[model samples]
Target: MTASHILLVDDDVELTELLADYLTTEGLEISVANSAEQALALLAPPARFDLAVFDIMMPGMSGLELLQQVRPSNPIPVIMLTGKGGDIDRILGLEMGADDYLSKPCNPRELLARIRAVLRRMQTPPSAPDTRVIQHWGLALQLAKRTLLFRDTPLELTSAEFNVITQFMQNPGVVLSKAKLTERVLHRELTAYDRAIDVHVSRVRQKLSKVLPEQELIKTVRGEGYLFIGEE
Candidate 1:
């Protein structure tokens, strides 16, 4: 996959510039915005950025504020920057549709690693011989198109949701424990209070239910995590 373009939204000009410079050398296309207004301008051309790094404390608009506003319509991946009290903000960000978060004073190398990991998780699956479309109750999952068609209506899904559903669909009729789901989809090992997987699953269930109201497509495995029931 190609390198991802990142937009850095932070009032810390020095840190933002430095991080941009470092990440550029690390193979990511980096853009720095010293304010939320500037970041919005950059994002106006949506395709320009594959992901965003937002700082929690900024002058006019805080990271959380920006997340709330942008998340409703924007589909680009997001990662938040939190110095202290990151725990609470981390959960909020994920719930608001952020893909990940990194504590402040985080190693630049780790940041680079995370950016890469998120991009990798967003990749479209390769074409193969047995890559047939899966249809159930008038909803079709096109593996080749990387899209979901509900009642013959095509629906767009975020990369995170697609990744989670892909993982579940690949293991139909089998139970997926939360731990395994977290590893397969999140691209990182488990962290304390890591409710990222649960959030993704919830989002998927909401979408699936909306499309297939009669089909209980995703079932809770109780002690385990979830299962995707394939049409037999």
Candidate 2:
């Protein structure tokens, strides 16, 4: 099997080099970019990566900006590394379309786990049937393709966002707890004060609203979780 390629973007040259060496041993091809500008240059043409790891706090363009710029045209999964206490940055990163966020000084194992989780979501399981499809109201979801269509119009969604809506469409009107949503969509356990799940949900809502402006499709059940209104 070909090794997965990853772009590691961070201003910390020492940290990026160390992670590149470590991640390489774990069967991943690591491409190093010491700054977001360089990262963009590498991503310009002919260069492709399965996933990208970016440090939230960078020299010129922050990870958030990088995500914003890349997401508009690129669907590559991104895992952001934020400062140890950068809760705000983490949340912002998710809202900006990051596939996952890890606190800086993260354990290599945990980072690897997150990377694998994101990659898994990026791929359709081999066991998945080709004809799998779900249609709710005007929304159509192609499970195998991991694509969604609203009134036959394709919607641009990150893999994480797509997974979140998939969960909602699968169990429409059923309230889904943050913990359950986190596990199902992010493939990770919910942690205390973790708002990544919520941010992803909000992003989904924003996209959905842009497509269906008349009514609210995702409703928040205060103090509880969220539910999808199948016919809103």
Candidate 3:
């Protein structure tokens, strides 16, 4: 089995070295990039990475800007490292298509756990031998390919967004609470005031709305949660 390769981007040299050593000791391949520009270079061809850990605050091009640039062409799952109490940065990272996030000055063990969780969600189960397509309304979700289509036109979705919509489509008309979604999609328990699940759902809704104007496929049930309105 090939080890997962991670690109760690941060301006703190000592911190990056510490994480790289710790993650490497845990049987994962690590690549260190001290700046967003360096990270972009490493992200280019011939340097495939399973996941990327980027610090939200960086010199020159910020992590958010780097994410915006990378997301359009690359679907590599990203986990942002934000400063403690940096709620806005965390939310912005998710809106820009990040899979998960961690607060900087964090415990290496926690970061490792989050990394494993995100990678696990991105993996396809070997038990499913054939492609399974779930069609609802005009949307088609190809489980094997992990692609979503609207009226046969492909709808781009990040790894997190893909999982978010999959849960909704599979359980149409079912109200999935934030706690359930966080566990299912992110493979972690929901923390108080954590809005990662909400941001992911919002992104999916925004994408769906572009192709599904005048149709509200996913509905919010006020205090309950979100419900996917399937064809009755």
How far does residue 216 in candidate 3 sit from its true spot (Å)?
1.0
Off by over 4 Å in 1: 1-3, 125-130
Query: Where does candidate 1 clash, by residue pair?
Result: none
lDDT of 2 by residue, 163-202 (tens): 9999999898899999999999999999888888999999
Top-TM-score structure, candidate number: 3
Clash totals for all candidate models: 0, 0, 0
Best candidate, lDDT-wise? 3
Candidate 3: clashing pairs of residues? none
lDDT string for model 1 (173-205, tens) is 889988888778878776676677787888888
- Total clashes for model 3: 0
- Arrange candidates by TM-score, highest first: which order? 3, 2, 1
The better-scoring model by lDDT among 1 and 2 is 2
**Candidate 2 Cα errors over 4 Å, as ranges:** none
Lowest summed lDDT window (length 10), candidate 3: 124-133
The TM-scores of all predictions, comma-separated, are 0.85, 0.94, 0.96
lDDT for model 1 comes to 0.81
lDDT of 3 by residue, 1-232 (tens): 9999999999999999999999999999999999999999999997799999999899999999999999878989999999889999999999988999988798999999999999999888779544778888899999888889998899989888889999999999899998999999999999988889999999999999898888999999998889999888
Candidate 3 global lDDT: 0.92
